[model samples]
Target: MKLAVLATGNIANKVTQTLVQIKELECYAVASRELSKAQQFKERFGFKKAYGSYEEMVCDPEVELVYITSPHSHHFEHMKLCIEHGKNVICEKAFTVNAAQAREIKSLAQEHKVFVTEAIWTRYMPSRSIINKVLSDGLIGDVKAITANLCYNVCHRNRVSNPTLAGGALLDVGVYCINFALMHLGSDIREIHSTWQKIDTGVDGMNTISIQYNDGRLANLTSAITAKSDRQGIVYGTKGYMVITNINNPSLIRVFDYDDKLIKSVEVPPQISGYEYEFIESVKAIGEGRIESWSMPLTDSIEVMTIMDQIRAQWGLRYPME
Candidate 1:
């Protein structure tokens, strides 16, 4: 599969580093607003071609898949651009600013009959299935609640503090916590209670959310851009509990009994950069003539975006683009 990246940002750099290690994918093209940046990325990663503009790269008929590494604010525009050009897209997390934009992108992708999926890497990791198997096998009998926290001291970065860029802790880090809960608990949410503290830029600097499920289960989640957190996801159950090392990219899963006796510890499988799974899945899906990935389907993407939209509504937070 020929792969093209649409940005020369930090994420693009990291993912490209892993792409060169994947034999199934070609580091075909990279585009940036500035040609020099794209050229540098091309030289650094050995990409076949570099484009000065996104439009120019997407215009290339040989580009099979375009990985979008733009900010949360530009996801809709970038995805739409790819889909309109009859190209398959794998966009970075937060899919869109809101559910409305997500739905619109979905409609456009369907109209174009192209493959499109969100690049939420956790959903596609092998550890996801391992965690699910543990829960399914009654290792955590009758799951009752979940607690996940993912935080980073990144407010100094413009993209993490700028409202116009749809920058905030929620979209950048909170989305992972939300996905962690939904991935394990299932999305039968009954009520959502949330609170947030804003930074000087009027974006959410820190936020806490409590989700009530229809089955009487609860998810207590927290995310912040101003401070650092342990980045753990704990699932409590009647028989025992499991502690996930890192919710962002789960490194290990440890199961225990009610007596706090450690039952088992499972380490995540080895990988290039823990990001190769999304690209691998996208390639498989496109080869199978599928429009969405089974790992992170469009419906799951929209549900997550909707939940964030509700949370923002509670705090009366709206991005400039929204």
Candidate 2:
């Protein structure tokens, strides 16, 4: 697979590096809004070409997959262009600013018969699935509650705090919280009640979301870009509970029982900087002519966006396009 990376930012660099780790894949090119930035990425990564615009990157005939790494606002346009040009894509998370835009782009990909997926690396990891299996086997007994908190002092003015860039702790950090909860608790969210405190940029700096699952389980979730936290998340039940330290990139699942006895402390798979599993799954699926990933299906991605949309609406936060 000849891949054209859509940005030169931190995540873009990670995606490119991850792709390079695969012997079957090649980073054909890298692109950034700034020509110098693109050249720098190409030089560092040894990519074949660099482009100042995403249009040029997508138009490269040698580029089979366009890994979009731009900000939220640019994802829709860039991915749409790639799909239109018959290139499959793996877009950054929070798939789009809204579910409406995400659906449109996905439909376009379907029409073009090109696979498009959200780069939710967590869903594709074997460690994640193993933990899921443990939970599914009732190793934790009847599920009770989920507690997810992700907080790191994003002290700087990041897009997560800027409305123009679809920034917020919810979209930036809390989506993973939501996804984590939904994963163990299932997608049928019974009720959602949330509160937010805005940063200087009019987007949420920190927020707490209370979700009630249809199965009578509760998810108490919180995210913050202005504060520091342990970043641990919990999933509980009548029988036992699973404690995942650092919900976003979990590397441990500690199970405890009703009597507070340690059921097991499972050592997760060794971690990698860029998360190679998701990219590997993308290559395998797309190479097999599959349109959606079985691990994180298109419907689930759409549902995640829908949940975010409603939460943002509740917070009275609107993006540039909205």
Candidate 3:
């Protein structure tokens, strides 16, 4: 599979490092608005070709897959461009600023017969099934509530504070918490209550979200760009509770008995930066002529975006693009 990355940012760098290790994917091309940066990225990551602009890269007939790592605000635009070119796309989390954009992309993808899915890597990782198995096997019987938090001290970065970029904790770290809840708790949400603290740029610096499921289950989530957190996802069940270390990238899942004694622990399988799974899945889906990845289906992506949209609506946090 030939792969092209659509950005030359920090995430692009990290993902490219992992891309080099995937034998199934060719480091085909990389694109940036600036030709020099693209050239640098191409040489650094050993991409076969470099494009001065995204349009140029997507225009390449050999580019089988495009991994979009742009900012949240630009995702809809970039995805539209790629879909129009009939390119399979795996976009970063917070698939778009809102569900409307996500829906439009979904429609365009179907119309173009192109594969499109969110690169919320957690969904594709082995740990997700590990956690699911624990719950399914009744190790944590009758799941009742979940508490997940993902926070980082990144407010100083322009991408975290710029309203024009759709910058905020909710779209970034908070999306993980939301996905963490939905992946485990299911998305039959009865009600959603959320509050946020805004940064100087009028974007959410931190936010807390509570979701009530129709099954009488609850999910409490928190995300912030101004602080660091333990990043744990805890599931409370009738028989026992499970502790997931790092909801962002779960490393270990510990199951505890009613007495708070650790009964079992499962460590996630090793990986090459935890991103290869999404790419591998994307490639497989595209090869199978599928329009979505099973790990993070298009409908799931839209639902996650819808939930985020509702939360932002609650906070009255409208971005410039919106």
Candidate 2 Cα outliers beyond 4 Å, as residue runs: none
Q: Is candidate 1 or candidate 3 better by lDDT?
A: 1
Candidate 3: tens digits of C-alpha lDDT, residues 261-297: 9999998998878988998888888889999999988
Task: By lDDT, rank the candidates, best first.
Answer: 1, 3, 2
- Model 2 scores what on Cα lDDT? 0.83
86-118, model 2: which lDDT tens digit per residue? 998888987888899888987897899998888
Q: Which 10-residue window in model 2 sums to the lowest lDDT?
A: 267-276
Error of 2 at 146 (Å): 0.9
lDDT at position 316, candidate 2: 82
The TM-score of candidate 3 is: 0.99
User: lDDT of candidate 3 vs native?
Assistant: 0.93
Reference-based TM-score of each model: 0.99, 0.96, 0.99
Which window of 10 residues has the lowest lDDT sum in candidate 3?
A: 267-276
Model 3, residue 209: displacement in angstroms?
Answer: 0.2
